[model samples]
Target: MKLTALLLSLSLTASAAIAQSDAASEARDAARDLEEAAVALQQAESSRNRIKALTQVVQSYEDGLAALREGLRRAVIRQQRLEAQLVQQEAEIARLIGVLQTLGNNNSPTLFLHPQGPTGTARAGMMLADVMPALNAEAAELRDALQEVRILRELQLGAADTLQSGLDGAQAARTALSKAISDRTDPPKRFIEDPVQTALLIAATETLEGFASGLTDMSPEPEGLAPLPDISHRRGKLDLPLEAEILLYPDETDASGVTRPGITLATRANTLVSSPVAATIRYRGPLLDLDNVMVLEPQPGLLFVFAGLGAVFGEVGEVIPTGAPLGLMGGNDPKIDAILSQSGEGSGQDRTETLYIEVRDGKTPVDPSEWFNINKDR
Candidate 1:
């Protein structure tokens, strides 16, 4: 009875939630996806492509966690809105409660009395027949509202367990993938780098543009390196390194008045950053302000610079196959309470970490939005 009363206190919130079809859909989808990843995590160790398998597992957990956050966000909004409605409807609710209390009194003298005689009683009976269906419908809705409260209560309890399981599974998968990257010696080396010149070049340059200008000339010195594939035909259609990704364009200025070149993407915690196309790693690791950068040369003059990675994989001058894991973005997944309490416009504004992507066709910077379809994907 105590539990029931508590749930009733939240009845309006749950009732509002019930009206929105997908209020809990994301939560359910997240649970199902995380559960599936748990099953796959067991087999990932023995799989032929452990890197890919484990990568998928981490991705699943991240995706599930993202969905779970959204579910909780919607729930918070629903409760707030419903609570406001309750304030507005307080008088009506009080009247209904009074009616209910009167109904509960079994010994009321006027319960079966009518003001008028035979014909009036007959008319009243007809009126009562008409009112019964609507009253029954209201009772049914109240019952459903109560049931929804129970479901929401159950979901809140389950979410704590879901969050813990997801965190463990995601961390385990990342550890396995990191090991796989470390143990592998199979990636075809494009050429041996004479880092002496590159290091000298880095020491001379203050900005990425200067280093890149020098790299354009120095990187071509390697002889007999196989030519990379032409992505000219695939100019507008390139796969993103992060899934369910959001992007910001160069034109959109932040609070401070400054413009940025290329496009920026927000990635999930330790999300697998992949090569969009077959390319050679011109340089990997940190340079300038960008932490743990990976620069790729798809063609002689075409360069793609990915920066702010937590970890970079593959060596300088190594051939990276398309969709190969480049590295991971730094950070741990959000906590269970954090996920529930997160609020803002939506997921776009909630991203805390950033991935800087700059593409240069020659000396001129290419807008990465050309390669990544933000409208279609985001």
Candidate 2:
């Protein structure tokens, strides 16, 4: 009876061990699924951002077109008025010519010699001189009017041509924007998982296994496991001197597949924030009269700024870490606090008007959403 009891006890221990192992395996699988879901969410956010940027571009172009159309309308009215004045001046000149012809017939030398006395002839000569000056003045005024009309007509034609060109440009911009919006709104055909995330999961799985073993053995688990940052480093990690969030996403596209990044955080006066990745600083200065604007490189990539947390931080060029306090939230502009990214296809210069952010591996830009925790639900 004692031997049978020992065997049963051993079997029960074996089954318990199997159950624990199975649970660990299930947990690891769940972790993987979670990671994949995160990636998908990032991709969706990227698509949304692209569409937004294109919408802005389209709206801007449309505004310009409207302004041009208004100007064109005004030009047409002015041109017509000038044309009418020119016709009226020509008619007046014709009437003056007829008067001059009648006067010439009456005052001709032959008419003066045949019937007119000396006093009448002398009076006719004086009248002729007076009329000659008036005729010349009228002729000069008509010529001036015609010249003015010609100049105005040329200007009108040029303006019309310019309006047509502007319309063409606006239409092209709208078409491009429409195509971009469509692409972004469309569901992603391919889903990409972050390799770094996969590696992290694998490491976590191994660590969890060790922790479970320690618990089973009644031993202490290893201390000091790295904690995840509150803000997920889903966007490619940047080792920048300044800390801030991406405010806008790029949606506009140029010939090159690059996007422009913009910043909303108010940096210290003249703070030199470097690029998150290795690229040139395309622009560094005030944007729209607001001080502390800096754009960074890698064709189309991240923008960084060292915000002046009044009384705490000094001016620009001061390096800060990824989460270091650059400045407090409130700024003069109420809407400047939001973070965004740009992603369509253009350089930062091409997209300087809007904010943009990008995730890249070395030189190639990847969707930042994959690497950064962009709160998609919000």
Top model number, TM-score: 1
How far is 366's C-alpha from truth in model 2 (Å)?
Answer: 46
TM match of model 2 to true structure: 0.26
The root-mean-square deviation over C-alpha atoms between each candidate and the true structure, in angstroms, is 5.4, 33.8
lDDT of 2: 0.35
Enumerate residue pairs that collide in model 1.
none
Q: Among these predicted structures, which one has the highest lDDT?
A: 1
Model 1 Cα lDDT, one tens digit per residue, 173-267: 88888899899885677788887888899899898888777888785455466677678888878877776354567655645664567667776
On the 0 to 100 scale, the lDDT of residue 163 in model 2 is 38
Q: Per-residue lDDT for 199-231 in model 2, tens only?
A: 443354433223222222321122233321333
Off by over 4 Å in 2: 1-71, 82-92, 102-107, 110-131, 151-161, 174-378
Cα distance off (Å), candidate 2, residue 86 = 5.2
Q: What's model 2's lDDT at 274?
A: 29
